[model samples]
Target: MSALAAGQRTLSGHLLAWALGALAALWLGFVVVGFRTGQHEADELTDGHLASVAALLLSEATNDFADPRRVIPTSDGDNLRAHDYQQSLSVVVWDAGGHLISRTGDAPLPPFAIAEGFATLELGTPAVPWRSFARWRAPAHDRRVMVLLSVAERDDLAWDIGTQVAEPGLWGLPVVALVLGLAIRRGLRPLDALSAEVLALDVQRAAPLQPRLRHQEFEAVVRAIDTLVARYHAALAREQQLASELAHELRTPLASLSLHARLLRGKTADEAERQQSLQRIEQDALRAGQLLGQLLTLARASRTELAEAAQPFDLAALARRVVAEYAQAALDARHELVVEAPPSWGLSGHPVLMELALRNLIDNALAHTPPGTSIAVQLDAGERWLQVCDDGALAAQKPAPAPAAQGAAARHALGLGLGHRVIDKVAAVHGGRFEQRPAPAGFSTCYRISLP
Candidate 1:
């Protein structure tokens, strides 16, 4: 169940998680900033109030000291305070002669020991703390006044005001999350639709996927998927065509071999006829073997993984070895074989597939061309290209490139035999292209592969 849940995790879920995490961090930051701002502003406002009230009380006093004006505004019309409001400002006054004067407000009279600036005082049974400011009247210097503010009251005021401001934001978090989640899910609907389209695709058909969305990313995805599906279909067609060709190519050789074998085994066989039948049997067997070998070689050439595992090898040396191995076959066919390459040319590629391609090219040149044809296997290290050129009537009769064909039989008739097709696939694996060009003066056509 846990594994299934993990697998079910979607893009929208991850997006929503990241967004919520960011919002939570922002909210935490806002709260920290708001709390500090509220506390700092509360302290400053209370300090200013203490200073202004003390100044006002001092200014309102008469020289005779008969009466003083009431500056404290604690008396509400309904005799009730605002919610969370608990403490009133305390006042205390004294003469410079050390005589007590007037005191007002609910808080107890602040002590004389209070200094000229702000101070904290411990008052009452459990010793509640008060913040006080004391100052003497200007010029007269005969009277001094002190105003007290409860520490707890100031803190409660700061927290209450800031909490009220931030409460709605906290309460609205759920609504914001709901909207964000819905937005993310709605935005991802295109992906769900894309997935459905892909799932509905058929392997038997090479239908192109239609672009259902104009989003840049989805368009790119559509293009990529389309390219992939096209390549898959092409590969599948090539495989089916190869199988059909092999089947068709095999029937003649197998039947010829069987017929020649029966003729040799028959009681009416003559010496000369028996020799011809034996020779025919050998040729048919050889043809069948060659057909089977081509099928496997083409299969290996089509494997893309071999290209990724390329290893460095001496290209020129490999060319020399392949030519040497085929030297007897060329002599048997009455063909002049040659190789023109540097002593050593370093390259990286699938050496096995490359050797197969070289062999195919040499075999194809000798098998399809007239006897005594001079075939040259030349490698141009500077250009990173190699070619097999033959001066034969077959190559001269066939143009450099025949018309493009889709079916295997069409390809064979057009001079793109199984061998040449193998070479083409091998070239593609090595990130190269195969070409047929006009041969040099002594040659009729050149089959070439060039690498980047």
Candidate 2:
């Protein structure tokens, strides 16, 4: 594939990657939050259970607290119950005087307060830590029968949570990314197919593109490609037609010139014969010049910058001057040339280009017609339009089409090869159009140069 094709493909890939990356970031954020939340929940459950156990021991010991000896054994039993029995917890008990009486295992006791009710405490230092909940029971009527129980455990709730909480997506992330990547590739398949279609196209076969873009997001690109294909096909057809017309137009004049030159070469040519041959040569040369000029005009009209330096000008005065210049030619052909434009008629465009387009039409009509034909120039002005038209007047009104007509017209339309290039370029730059139509009597061409 070409660089442009690769760039387009890469663009789609980039977009897919970006979208997926954003989703992944959001998912990861949720996962992090979920992990933290799970740890917090585990800590709460462990603390809550320990508190319940402490509360149970406190209730049991409260009955025996009147006598120190009786309460000591029960307190020891409570400590053992929390530690030796439960594999995950440690325990300690303190008397009403804040003296440590019993302990379960070698786990250090959390630095709990001697006050009544329950309290959570962190043991060790800030650097290394363990935590526990302590329950202190001292009924209002029995100040001497006070007891304290503490349930202690190592603080690794976060680690325990990691082990217990199941993440359904833990093993599914890679799989999901792979699936999404594949889906992205599949979704963009239509673009690849469209590229291949365009690459295979040529002037001879400018087939319209019909790619299956499953996603709505890609529809605009597909439509644009299709529209481009259609325009390309139309342009190719026009080019071919122009070529045919060029050949036809040049055939008769070229043949005549060649034959006359051959005749002069064959015999001992007299001065008169030589002069006749030379005159024919000159005539043919002039015809060739005329054809070349028309082709050039058409080329100019199709150029992208055909009217870059356009300026406002009085349409009426310009028309009068053009008509005056053609007055002598019209009279020679026994035709009348008249200009009918209002003094207020004004327009904006490249004056030279506009004059060229108008002159070509008049010259073409007069050249094909006989003497005594009437031609009138008229300008119609409106709020949005400035139109110029010519009345058909002349003999031989339906002369055979010129060989260069198609070349001229096609170039004129697209500003493609030569003359049309100039016209199209100027027309585009000026934001204008060139129109030609068969006149009621002969033919008329109009150049509607818009004004700001």
CA shift at 202, candidate 1, in angstroms?
2.2
- Model 1, residue pairs in steric clash: none
Location of the lowest summed lDDT over 10 successive residues in candidate 2: 141-150
What value does the lDDT take at residue 218 in candidate 2? 67
Segments of candidate 1 deviating more than 4 angstroms:
1-6, 63-86, 105-115, 121-128, 211-213, 305-351, 365-376, 390-416, 441-444
Provide backbone clash counts, one per model: 0, 32
lDDT of 2 by residue, 1-452 (tens): 58776567485678678877887887777667777777778666666666776766666634332332232234344454454223345556666566655555334444534344445444444423344555566463222212222333323555456435537446566777778888888877777776676677664555655545456766787677677677667655755666576667667668879988997887788889889898787677656665666555654544423235657877678778888998887765556677767776767666777677556546644554445445666666664333344443323464633555433322223111334444443444456654443444343433343433
Per-candidate alpha-carbon RMSD to the true structure: 7.2, 8.9
The lDDT for every candidate, in the order shown, is: 0.78, 0.56
Superposition error at 49 for model 1 (Å)? 2.9
Backbone clash pairs in model 1 (N, Cα, C under 3 Å; residues 3+ apart or in different chains), count: 0
Runs in model 2 deviating more than 4 A are 1-16, 61-130, 138-154, 163-168, 188-203, 206-230, 259-277, 296-359, 362-386, 390-452
Error of 1 at 115 (Å): 4.4
